[model samples]
Target: MLVFFTFVILLALTVTNSKQTFVILKKSREDWILDGIGLFFQGIAIPFFQIAVVFQLYQLLLPDTRASLNLYPIAAFLLSFVFVDYLYYWNHRLFHTRKLWFIHQVHHTVTEMDVLGTSRNTLWTSFFIVYLWIHSLFIYLLQEPNWYILGISLSSALDLWRHSSFSPTVNSWLYRCLSPWLILPQDHAWHHSQFIQGNYGANLKLWDKIHKTYHKSDQVPDSLGINSSLSLSKKLFLPLE
Candidate 1:
């Protein structure tokens, strides 16, 4: 999935330079190293969380046990997507609070938008992300583990597009139609905005609208990220600090 999006962004960059488009054309080596560390953390967190999810599911599904809710597989799959998105909506907002803000601030350090920026969270943030911790449990309870994985995988692929600097051609009618339902690149860019708030949904804009946290504007933000005085090491060890 990462390679595929990298190719798409490269192709888009060839057609439109970063200045005209939202795609960030250049990234520093330090940024790449930070992203690598983030990925390393993600690698560790994924297996650990998966183990916990499996253990929880095993406890729920003992020898003679049945699922708590047995909806049709298709319905369960669809509902899982909504459930995770809803979970993420609130959890993401919480991360912006004073307590969790420092941990999440690593990702926002990027002054530009790119696919790699999506992976740029702190070492522990991935582990504590609400969706990662609970989404699998919801999948098991719904009795749609396979379908749920597929749905979330598809949703995640779409999320990669949201982080890109690329935008659809103005002539494309499909872009206009789906712009409202899905989080487009520009909409998400504002979420990374230095001075702006709102636009906090991941895959769908429904929750943001319902919660009145949605920021609807075509204007790009003036800058990205907060001005921090902490040293790099201090920022990385923010949780402990």
Candidate 2:
């Protein structure tokens, strides 16, 4: 979920690429609506979802338990976010595979990169996330701290970075200062490429590499969109089915 927050940074990166893209977004209704909705869901709704799932997990872990204003709950939240991002790497890849592409193609339908471009996803993707179940499972198993909720919050907030068009200054610095421990804009953008038969992890490229899904690139993509046919209304509603 915090992976979702990093997307805002990705949006900033996209804007820095050129003023023309910003000008174009300012004129589009979809951009405005998508940003508004994405912000709310990622901010308010996502926290509520986390809280709800954490509460449920507590109850399941101790069927007769009542929560204290304690630290353990927060720890559980943090552990959940860390684990989810790892699982999400593969889940995101699954979305791009044969048969599954029918769902993920909706996200790729966006032909451009921008802040709003991240919202171009099939609604069903949400259901597939099953955030509550996964979060609950992590809490039950890890018995992590309540303070860890901070990580979950941070993870959701930073997800904005994944969809941004912004290139990094560290293209040269990453190898020295960073390890491919987590996913970056360039890694995610690879998932949106016209040739996306491989490299599909989000939030971490290391998993992609280990899984033999990694691809190296020197530039941000010049084009993006789904390879299949779709209608606007269908794209919005297909997730329901």
Candidate 3:
């Protein structure tokens, strides 16, 4: 329900922004296919994999530990939103390294801020993401995972928003409140820019700041994404040197 609401809000924002909507509509056919397939894999297939494969494997390997965790609701939420988020911050940073950039570069190919391109990546890229494993393990171990699940849903929704051009205005109260701590759309746009070296966090800017990787800017980059000569097949399957 929350996820649905978030989608509705993002769609409304995109529709209301004529320029943003035009940019989205103007995406190339290859962009459409890559983003569409990536979204489907991440949104549908990954969750199914988490449940049917990862969670079940945990059940088999740790049979006696199922629901062994009895954390308070707030603790559970923080476990996902803070601790796991911190882990993912590093996970995302690692993807920018030369060793792993091949698998992650496809995601940064989006030339604009559009929610549809949020999940753009090679099909198997999810396997390397920390969320795929940590989320399932925690869900399997938590006796009452409602709060944790809420955290996951909110994080996913925020990812969609931060990847899109649906941010609150800089002069607005909402932007003032969120910009100080949270990762915003413009912040992430910098991460997706031609110089994709910083702002690797998904939720909070704290990790990036602490690690001295945060690129503070009020304006979006003049240019976004890197030029890749790789064919569609390579973008979807093969990794480059």
| TM-score of each model, paired residue for residue | 0.80, 0.72, 0.96
Residues 22-97, model 1: lDDT tens digits: 3333655666677667655554556476667654665666534425667776776676578778888888898888
Query: Which parts of model 2 have CA positions greater than 4 angstroms off?
Result: 1-23, 26-39, 49-78, 136-144, 170-175, 227-229
lDDT of candidate 3 vs native?
0.91
lDDT by residue (34-69, candidate 2, tens digit) is 445645654466547656866565676766434322
Q: What TM-score does candidate 1 reach?
A: 0.80
Which residue pairs in model 3 clash with each other? Answer: none
Local distance difference test, candidate 1: 0.70
Worst 10-residue lDDT window, candidate 2: 64-73
RMSD of each: 3.7, 4.5, 1.6
lDDT of 3 by residue, 153-236 (tens): 999999989998878888899999999999999999999898758999999999999999999998899989988888898888
Q: Model 1 misses residue 99 by how many Å?
A: 2.0
Ranking by lDDT: 3, 1, 2
The TM-score leader among the candidates is 3
Each prediction's whole-model lDDT (CA) = 0.70, 0.59, 0.91
TM-score pick, better of 1 and 2: 1
